[model samples]
Target chain A: MSHVYERVALIGLGLIAGSMGLAMKAHGLAGEVVGTARSKDTRDVAVGLGLCDRVTETAAEAAKDADLVVLAVPVGAMGAIAAEIAPHLKPGATVTDVGSVKKHVVEAVSPHLPDTVHFVPGHPLAGTEHSGPHAGFATLFENRWCLLITDAGCEAGAVANLRALWEGMGANVEEMDADHHDLVLAVTSHTPHLIAYTMVGVADDLRRVTDSEVIKYSAAGFRDFTRIAASDPTMWRDVFLTNKEATLEILGRFTEELFALQRAIRTGDGEQLFDYFTRTRAIRRGIIEAGQDTEAPDFGRGTSRK
Target chain B: MSHVYERVALIGLGLIAGSMGLAMKAHGLAGEVVGTARSKDTRDVAVGLGLCDRVTETAAEAAKDADLVVLAVPVGAMGAIAAEIAPHLKPGATVTDVGSVKKHVVEAVSPHLPDTVHFVPGHPLAGTEHSGPHAGFATLFENRWCLLITDAGCEAGAVANLRALWEGMGANVEEMDADHHDLVLAVTSHTPHLIAYTMVGVADDLRRVTDSEVIKYSAAGFRDFTRIAASDPTMWRDVFLTNKEATLEILGRFTEELFALQRAIRTGDGEQLFDYFTRTRAIRRGIIEAGQDTEAPDFGRGTSRK
Candidate 1:
């Protein structure tokens, strides 16, 4: 692979940014990778890990002269970081983001970016429960979807170049409208995460079952929820807060469906429950066929030890 | 390892019973293992896989002269199978089960058993989404819990022998009251399964996000739910039907807490969402510390292909 950008600045060196640094270096996709984080500890760790060619103390310093600038901070912090680095952005440079909530991120950061720079909001549809500078792996985005938002005013060449960078890093790239992306993610990621968090919370409050027992016997089904609920709280908080309408919309649908299923259980409607479960099983098959998940038993959880 | 029973019979050759057969044979825990399933296809598959030493046509024929009989069918079918096999049970034989809902199984199967036989209800808190005879593996129950309900009138030697057999199959055994076991499972397994099914169903029903998109982008949290939702529909249907009261109770609590979190989201209460999410993360850490799940990213989903 060859360099897609002369220099790339990654603001907020967390999992996505750190992984981008490692993956870009591994694939030789960027000429020079410069990164900055708000936390000294994160910056120190990134420097120690050699994640970036240059570790700067500020987003502005990192953005200076960079051909591509990635706002890899939490969604809530995107606007401030965008403003901080706006004046320093090189002319004709492309600025993108790795925020989970794309609509709010575009709303948050687009105004702060100069008209000379291409602002293409992007979200990589991949993550591990683990976070921080040390939690990233080079192959994290491999075979994952990275959706880019090409709102009006975004240059076609800049979007294509950004897409090539992500594809070179081993992601399948697609373009989506910012609002549609948020709604789709609300169904696919945000609402499910809230549900997982809520279920784990409910289990925690159940005194009769005991937390130790919940932990010990979690392999049955609840353990999957725990894995999801273990995601970064601050990141998820920003996700729900920023994508409020879509997340709540999906959650409301979830609750309505949940009540119907609860009534089925309460009324001993085996056929209703059976039909609903059977339909969901077909979706699982679709996912496996799509290569999004493994068909091995228990999501291959038993054998998934590193 | 010495034989725990001279002859063992497994009725309904599904995942659990088939696994028990393979595990027992692997450990030399039974002198002879016989199994029977309602479907001819299942029986043929069991014989083809060499899952049992003998494949019988009927539950009674499999139960005949066997020192241990395991009713491994769905919870709703336990009563009928018990009635069918009760007449042929050998004297002093230990009659056990591997049903998910114990109280209902005990209620359904106990009355049909003769007084000369010891009826000890057991539930192995382990399984995968896969079903049928071909889904069994020798290590399915390894390091998992198998709860035995030793109610009054159950012989101590029978309980011990059953526990020893499970131990031989690499399961940690525990004794609990049937009612408490049902309630605990409702909180841990049944309700979680229902929630997963409902979420998957809701995703399926969403018109805005095409099914292809949902499947393609499912890796972010939704894939886990799909795996859980892919569990055998008939078995889950029976689980909910049999364990109605407890499942409904947990679902009630789940909805109550979900509403609170929903309200927090609606009101932009980031603190409430953050604290709840943080508390749930501690539980996830506890589960990892207790060795119930992997702390690896994505539940080590990428590396677990073997």
Candidate 2:
């Protein structure tokens, strides 16, 4: 593919930014990809791994003269990075973020960005449990949804260009309202992650069933929870803290539904449990049909794949 | 892998029993495998797939003259099947089961068995979301745990032979007390499945977030829960109904831990959230170290496999 941006600055060279760099380079979608991280070690690693064309010591240096700037830091850290790079961003440059919770990111970064630069918050709905520059792969965003907050009143050309960049990097781009995106993600990602973390914690705290046993026999089902719970703690912490209202609201609904299921088990209501479980199967089918997940058994773990 | 049993009878032609049939045949572990299912269509499928050497119309017919009779039906149906096959079971035959909840299976199946027969309940801690005879694979139990309840006072030879059969089918066998097995599974499998089902149900219930959006964007962690939730409804209902006390206990602890984390989010206690999440990561590492799950990203989905 041809270059979508003359230069792209990635602030916070973690999984998303690293993947962006690799994917952009693989597709020839950016003329130059400059990256910076809070830690010198991460920046050095990114540089060593060729995750960026060049490494910058500061977000300002990276943002300077870049046609596109991506804030890929923790949601809680977005505002500070935005402010640090605000003055350096080229005029008419498009600035977007790859944060899990978009409303919080928009609230955190938009005010800090100068009016000269167009701010369009974006979140790619794809990831592995692994993090860091080393964990990223060029195809990470392939066939994944990258939702852009076009309702933020950015110029049409800016939004379209940003969308093209994402699409060129192998993502399907769609525009979503920031608040709606947060709420939807709270239901889809945030709440599920918290539940996985909580379940893993409870298993660890259990003395009767030793941790070894939990680990050894995890293939029964619990292993899936651990995979999700194993995601980056700092990024997840920011997610829950910044997306508080929506996550808590979803969690409340989750607990209510959980209590009802618990009651069904306690009361020996087999039909209720059966019906509830059967209904949920349709959603799984929908996901498989949507090509979001594989239908292979056990997520095709240990299975031959091509 | 010489014949572990002269003739084996599988009393339910679902995933587990069908897998046992294929695995046994693949390893030459049984001279003949006869399978029976309640539905005629399932019996035909099992026979057509060569999951069994022969298909029997009734549990009694399959149990007759078999050296090992495996009660592989849903937990709730074990009692009825055991009672149905009790009269026809061969003298000195080993009666084992592959049920998730061991205590209930023991209670449901042991009473009807003749004193001449040995009752040993077993559970293979391996499966996929898929069900039915068609879902079975010869390697389904490879490197997975098969817990046997030898504490039920079955003959030593019978227990050893059962263990050998599971080993022949590529499972690592362990002896566990029936009650402890129930509790461990409650913490590991039953509760996780319930939570997943409930989360998926809640997502489906939300009218505001269209189902299409939820399905389309599910790869962001929600898809894992959907896979778990998509598991066979009838089997899960039976699991919860039979393992009620232990499941409820784990669910109680889970809710307690979840509430604490929820409070942390509400109060902006990032430290607690981060610490809890970090601690949970250790379990995932342990699972990987224990060889229970692959370290491949996203369970190695869409990746080339050797």
Candidate 3:
């Protein structure tokens, strides 16, 4: 099938944007990909790596005449990027994003958009612990879900075109309301990241565990937390700041349940602990069935530090 | 180097026991490896899989005339297994275990031990979500840690020999008082496992998450919890039940910390959350540098998860 857009503009060429640029180039999904970054060093590296056909320092300069524009900055920076590029965007351009939180993005960017263009807010549910243009790859989005959140009054044709662009990059696409999307993600992504970061931090502070012992035994369960905790601090800082209500709600529920389990352990309530352990197993099976993640072996690629 | 034990007997041929049997067989570290199981079906499976040279139903029967007898059963059953085998064990036989909790195992097994026999309680900090004899492999203990805990006047040479046996099975051996081991592990493993089980259970109880979204979006983070919660239910039940005090103490601290972070999020305390996130990244790096775990391309494996 022929590629959809003649020119694709990526504002903020970090991991997500650079990855999209690589996927677009490898799949022939975009005729020309233009990218911009906040720092000159990043733009130089992106240009050197050929992540895009052209690299610029300003969002508006990069978005000039582009058929599609993806706002790929951190959540807190969305409004600023939107404002910078609003005056330069081509008429009828389809604008979307690769942010983790959708409602916040919609609320932040929609007001700055031109009525002539299609604003379809999206989130590609994919990433690794690494960041920056150097960390991206052509197959980064393969087999992952790219969720787009838009409303009834928006241009359905434009949503279809954005969906096609993501599908061409090997991502399965789905749509949901912006608010529901934020809540779903707060459970699946945002809250979990916060909990993991907190747990790892707690372990780090415990004198009895000794930094050596904690790390040595991390494979038991704590290693999983570390991987998530190692994620970009700036990105997550914005995530929690913007998705506050949803994250706090889920986190509140998690603590209530965690305390109950703690009480069970203290009182030696084996039945309650056993029942909880058993119920959670079914969720893992469902994930396998959904074909959303790995089942038996280590969840990710198995390369470990020597 | 020459092999350590001439005849090694394994009591309870489940995942750890079976894996040890396979590792010994692969390395030719033992002249004969016999195993015991409570059920006839398990005995049959063990023999069929060649996990043992001889399979029996009674721990005493397996310990008879053996040079080394290793208890790899649920923690709750350790005392009974120790009592049953003490009288029948060969004079000078070395006994060890792979229980998660250490102090209880020592208390349960030490008093029942005959003077001629040496009892060294151990915990191999390695395993997968899988269970049963079929999950056994020779490499399961490779590069893993086996914490041996005891303060009893067991002979120094005896402990050395047991350490040799574990190292032969591809483990690094460390020593600590059983109580300290329990305290250390509660923070590192037990508390984390309990929290994971509880969080996933909470999601499971909510009808909205269970009907579909939780499983679909679990890849974002919740799936990691399921992988942990799926750990052998009986094994974890015994872990919490046996290591009650330490588990509860660490858990109390965790809830307090989790609550503080929750307040930070609710009140938009970005600095608090950011500091916690930043501090935790060092622990992951410490783990990699310590060689306790790997942090290469795909969790030390080659490629990333699909």
Best by DockQ: 2
Poorly placed runs, candidate 2 (over 4 Å): A207-211, A303-306, B303-306
lDDT of 3 at B136: 80
Count backbone clashes in candidate 1. 0
lDDT of 1 by residue, A44-159 (tens): 99989878987899999999999999999889999999999999889999999999999898888988888889898999998899899998778988899999998666788999
lDDT, candidates in the order shown:
0.90, 0.90, 0.83
List model 3 lDDT by residue over B223-296, tens digit each: 77777777888889999999999888878777788888878877888898788778888888887787765565
**Alpha-carbon TM-score of each model against the true structure:** 0.98, 0.98, 0.96
Docking class of 1: medium
Cα lDDT tens digits, model 2, A1-306, are 778899999999988999999889988999999999999999999999889999989999999999999999989999999989998888999999999988888887888888898999999988889998888878888888899988646799999899999898788999979888988898889999999999999999873446478777888889999999999999999999999999999999999999999999989999999999999999999888988888988877773321
Report the Cα lDDT for candidate 1.
Answer: 0.90
TM-score of 2: 0.98
Q: Which one wins by TM-score: 1 or 3?
A: 1
Model 3, residue A215: distance off in Å is: 1.7
